[model samples]
Target: PVGGELASHQWRTEHFNNPWLLGAAVLVRDETAINYNWGYNAPAPGVAAENFSVRWTGSVYFGLNTEYTFYATSDDGVRVWIDGGLLIDRWQDQSATTVSAKRYLTEGTHPVIVEYYDRTGPAVIQFWWEPGAPPSPPSVQPFEIIVDDQDPGFQKAGPTSSWYFRSVGYKGHTYWTYNSDAQLYNSAKWFPQLPQAGNYQVYAFVPKQRADTKNARYRIYHSGQEHSYSIDQSIYFDKWVSLGTYYFAANSTEYVYLDDITGEPYASKKIGFDAVKFVSTAQPGPAVTPAPPPVTPVTPTPTCSIAPILGFGQVWNTNPTVRQRLGCPTQAEISTWSAEETFIGGYMFWRGDLRLIYAVYNNGTWQSFVDNWDEGQMESDPAIVPPAGRYQPKRGFGKVWREQAGVRDKLSWATAEERGLQASWQAYNGGLMLWTQTLGVFVLYNDGTWIQP
Candidate 1:
């Protein structure tokens, strides 16, 4: 054998930025069924905005060594192979559809491979399988299981909106979200744990009445970016309407969100949230989640003095959130991280092993790599300064800055607001001002002393 070492059937997963599986792809946190309907929005946190692909590999164990039927319910394109043999091959961009095949196999472990691409718009995919029952011939579809609203799979899972399962709407009964005046922020969710993980087609059974608005919206939260969709509830009553397709992660924070924007143009009309469905689509080659390389242990630190890093006299008596995130600094020194934001002193603490620890003298703000690197928030959220009655993003800066690959690429700091200022950099009301061309006006505050906003 080449190299005298067999390439183990270890699972490998990769995510693509381009829909065609070409160009370059990122290694995702995990591989999953592509059953998502991120209508008019990014797929998931850290995923591409649109046009992406996914590939996964693993070994499967066929029980009884019998022939198994496999399905691929997908939009765009998909290809599957098991034990070096092709099973399902439907490669084209189209509406959500299903295709299947039967294959004989030896029992025990066999390698499986899957590849998929989403060219545009709402995207979904699923892989499903079961013991074969043989030729249903053409024109007739095979059997599939559906997870409905009234079923145990449907769950109440949201922190933003209120909802109720009503008997007066779509198919026998429908769950509806009320008090949705907040639009994007208000949301209701439908979560059903599938029998297994793979691609699945999702549909909604919602009815619209004259009193309802036409622009009811829902967001499909799946493995990638959360999908946003607008539906006019005035038509398609009780029909099994497609809500695109998506890859749903089991036990992951994935769920469909029905927002409260019931078309304000329709004169404060109410929105409808009803039964949703998930039908089996594609089946994975292996039943196991791909494992990543073991995490390297955090290295032990060398002993160091703390007086210089702590600025002569500084206590960990402020911003618990930041303190909890960054941990106690072992050896900190005055830093000049940002040239614009002036401070009495900025401290860069070393926790070793490439850990990032930052602290500012003002209000004793500090955070470790968790809040800074993992969460990737540029500024500590709510920079709470209870001792001084001042908070981060105070007043004109109450908003949190969005995350970007780089701090400079972000549109604006979360706290800055547009006030129609003209100068590129100016001092306003005793605060530093910069009219950033990237987003909006920004004002920075730096004082050795504390003051309330």
Candidate 2:
């Protein structure tokens, strides 16, 4: 009789083989025997073996080393073997079950055989693995900066309203005023006081109909005086026009006022003002060199050993032996070894095991140099190029070497062993304290700045 329909036809019909015989007739169902088909079948259900074993050639072993999970519904049975040795064998009657196993094997090819049966529900089997699994690399953390309207010190005032000064009435609105001296203007007005001395661009929105007909005049008052400039050009009405930029000197007070003197009656009646905005155009001054504020320099709690390197002015050394001796290779990328000092010129060198490199800042341009040594022969001129400001020299040696008058002479070298001299140079003169590493160069500045090149 044929096994259940869910079983593979090939497995049910295939003959079993053993060492003693090429082919053996194995009874799948024998109700007379209580332990039928090696106790894999149930007698009450008219036992049948859905899977028949077959052997050929040498012993079969599915030599695999990885994760393998088995899934089956209603009833599931599986057995794993290596070199004719059973690794796992389970014959059970139960609900769906999932199992995972990992094993290692020899390099030679192996065989994998699985037998599964589903009595009343779905069945599935899958296996997967990743050899030589490695840990995930680190990733850069992300950040963001947010800015709002209130950050710039500006506030909005609602819809426009008309100010009446005299008996002049336009359209249905009468402009008769008891106070004749009060000037009639729009709702928008500049701040009564200027925040600080800076160039400011003012934007005003006036209706198009009024802007086209009536020529508008406006003046900006700064430092208690009205600016001589006037906005006489017809602006696009209902649109924002830069009323032009005005400069307010340090400690100056400013405001803006508008007057409608156009003789067209229709233009005067329709002229309405919307909003006004003020933006600063002042450039910030160079950062001030902060005074060394008097503070009790806390004596660091003395530790067992001093830090490996001293922090000081820029230092340059091309000895790979020194770099390795100082434990520099492991710290090439994260540490700063050299720095630029503001002096007759701005430039410095960061020494690495592979080369003697320099970072030169002439005027404001920055360039990098890579040095190539010809062993015992005379050294060739270093190749110079513009680097992406941050330097990592694992690829090769980089030296910022150029014969510009103010370039090479400016570098003042100090050693990691000379702590006092390094500290003095850092305190008095600004430059980099360089550390040479196998991967690249590291620079530390006197002012607590570090750069990797």
Candidate 3:
């Protein structure tokens, strides 16, 4: 008996029984088999050649309490019976196909009878079942961060002559603007040598502005060939969006260029670009709890938001084709959430949960890793606008906290209620904890309270 929560069941049966025997003279081939030429010559008189009979016993006792999946290359037919009960009679002239059915039977030895005929070409019948529990669905490898830039070194592709500069920003590190004419085509290249050819996605901090078709456009290039795509900024103000994605072939150099550069009145207003990040199409290795080490004390750097270290409690999901074709484990269950990606030195310290899975492309190569986050914990609603200097967390549970030398540290933690006016706090020198709230900005003290400056 195929076990589980009894998802569903179907039964059908058909019989082609003739009430009249046609042409009685049956030639015995081996005393066990007889060849009766019913359609042609030498049938005794009064023998009917064609006839049909019907009997509804309601069921057949074939005792075949097993589930079966039938496949036919050209044409096929099947008649099944269980415990002498006629269940399925699906005999029809059809093309090659596949069908499945589940049957229940008594314990011990159960009888099963299946009459399958392949009419045209390739024919096959196979059955497999989970005797007790249903098999678990396949998993996808976790997503991983392929290329990252901390500062200084990460630069944008220059004009037809100069490349964009990577600069430090109030949030973290960002790319500088192109001083060249907007109409003039320019690009910024990361120059990171990719491991293989796969689906690759590019992320960057782009200054937001009003929608103008003639304004700046974003494009990616692999092996010097322009990839087809554009960013949509109709819904956002001046903020960051995952510029979208493109394909990168193996052993190829990739770069992103901004074209149709317009909106000068707006471009001159902003100084530099945002952070640029590139990740591979491969899944990240399993999450390993890093060994504890001494906390390195350092001055608190200004942070846009805090990022939390995630645990196994997180889950995710992605396109099935990405999972099956590219060997990416679907984030369908907890056991499969293994890979991780950490975005450091940015406006927000974010991490991608599934870094091990890669999506397969139509060209047989796998695409870059597509991070799938926990829907309930992480923000999945694409419509939710991000606040100033804040972009979407890569994936998984996001925690806003302070870190000192890669170790999690608290900078005077306080409850949401204690952050209001009636709060008194002590001051500690060199402990930089700048807290910016909706109303205004303030600093935190060792006593776990806020003091507005």
lDDT of each: 0.44, 0.31, 0.31
lDDT of 3 by residue, 159-277 (tens): 53433433343254444443334455444444446555554456555534323232234555664345333333334444544543444665545665554354344344223344444
RMSD of every prediction: 23.6, 30.0, 26.9
* Candidate achieving higher lDDT, 1 or 2: 1
Rank all candidate structures by their TM-score, best first, as comma-separated numbers: 1, 3, 2
How many pairs of residues collide in model 3? 63
Best by TM-score: 1
* Runs in model 3 lying further than 4 Å from the true structure: 1-183, 195-200, 207-216, 222-226, 233-240, 243-252, 261-273, 281-453
Candidate 1 lDDT by residue in tens digits, 251-356: 5576666666553542356656667766554332221111111222122222222221221122122323212222322233322222122111222122222122
* TM-score to native of every candidate shown: 0.30, 0.21, 0.28
Whole-model lDDT, candidate 3?
Answer: 0.31
lDDT of 2 by residue, 1-453 (tens): 112112211221212322121344443321111111233432123323333332111112222322223222223444433222233344454454545433333222333334333232333232222232222322322221111112232222332343332222122122111111224433223443444555455555443343342234455555443432223224453454454445455342455554444333433334333344555543222211111112221222213122223422112234232222122111112232333322222334433321233433311222233333335633324343223332212121212223323234322111111111111111111222343322133443221222332
Q: Lowest lDDT 10-mer window, candidate 1? A: 287-296
User: Least accurate stretch of 10 residues (summed lDDT) in model 3?
Assistant: 308-317
